[model samples]
Target: MLNGLKVGDKAPIFEGLDQNGKKISLKDYKGKKVVLYFYPKDNTPGCTAEACNLRDNNTLLAEKGYQVVGVSIDSVESHKKFETKFELPFPLIADIDKKIVEQYGVWGEKKFMGRTFDGTHRTTFLIDEKGIIAHIIDKPKTKDHYNQIIETWEK
Candidate 1:
């Protein structure tokens, strides 16, 4: 498993610029459940689908006391365009330096279409109000990620 981090572990704190260039930190959401999701890139098919799924269910997530945060190696500019294009309602961290991904251990080797490359793995950490990881979704279904999250937490 990435980072060897497991449920109940304290999540690594992160601070970075979001799509709007606003500073966001994990500490800022203290006392709130956090849906910390890491995607490979912005605008890719799977990534877009995953983001839109979260966006569509953002209200429900908030109603359940969950705050969503996205992170990728994409730049702030790229994130801005992606956010605008998709009308995403959550913060997309412009992790251009890969610090957050590295900290989360989501950055690593990946394979696609008979090719291998180093990139960010799609992963989600369900963080509780206390900043401890309550669960981890190592392979989220992009098209139905909202349901997946809700089910995981409900269990």
Candidate 2:
């Protein structure tokens, strides 16, 4: 098992192409709080719900000084389609190479319907402005993810 990051750990920095083919680097968000979330796929039910929840709460998250960034092994084209279809306001990183996901240690074995396979885990890392991990949500509540994040930070 890869050693995943945790609270108080310095977040691993990486860059990838966003849905629009724009290069987005973790270093660019240095002075801003970042919510880096890793999911299994694009256009999936749970993933869609989580993304929509975040989209609906975008203003609130922005007002609270948190910028959201999503990462998945899905291609840029797939991400673009998902964003356009769902009106996602945040940048979704297309980690097709799996570099960023591996760096963050979110890629792992998962079991679904009694079938086991390696995949990206649904994880969220709340990073403070200094790039230190403020909190790590391993089992995020898809529908109430925004509230969970806000409450975690508030606590």
Candidate 3:
């Protein structure tokens, strides 16, 4: 488990394909605050709700100068469907190899239906303009976690 990527740690660098099949790199988002969230899969109830929350709050987040991105081990095609279904305005990265997930320490053992499995653990990282992690939300919720992040940013 990541335990967490604490404040002041260098934000993990990643280069992955987006839903549109375009490559996206964490370095490309440098000089701006970035919200990188990791979820287990797309279209699942909790993941859907969490993504919707980020989608709905995206405008405000942009106004606040934060770029919100969702990541999962799902394929680019799956991300496309999820983005369309939710009308999401931001990019969602396809991490099929789970490399980025492992780098950020979001991929780990999790208990689901009383069975343990290795999967994304609903983690969110707030990387500052300097590309250093400013905060980490390891126990992410399906709603208002975006708002919670904004609040944290305000502090």
Candidates 1 and 3: which is better by TM-score? 1
lDDT of each: 0.96, 0.94, 0.89
Give residue 23's error in model 3 in angstroms: 0.4
lDDT of 2 by residue, 1-155 (tens): 25657789999999999999999999989999999999899999999999999999999999999999999999999999999999999999999999998998989888999999999989999999999999999999999999999999998
Ranking by TM-score: 1, 2, 3
What alpha-carbon RMSD in Å does predicted model 2 have with respect to the real structure?
1.0
Q: Which model is ahead, 2 or 3, in terms of TM-score?
A: 2
Worst lDDT 10-window in candidate 2: 1-10
lDDT of 1 at 30: 98
lDDT of 3: 0.89
Error of 1 at 123 (Å): 0.1
Residues forming the 10-long window of minimal summed lDDT in candidate 1? 1-10
**Model 2: residues >4 Å from true position, as ranges?**
none
Pairs with backbone N, CA or C atoms under 3 Å apart (clashes), candidate 2: none
Model 1 Cα lDDT, one tens digit per residue, 117-154: 99999999999999999999999999999999999998
Angstrom error at residue 70, model 1: 0.4
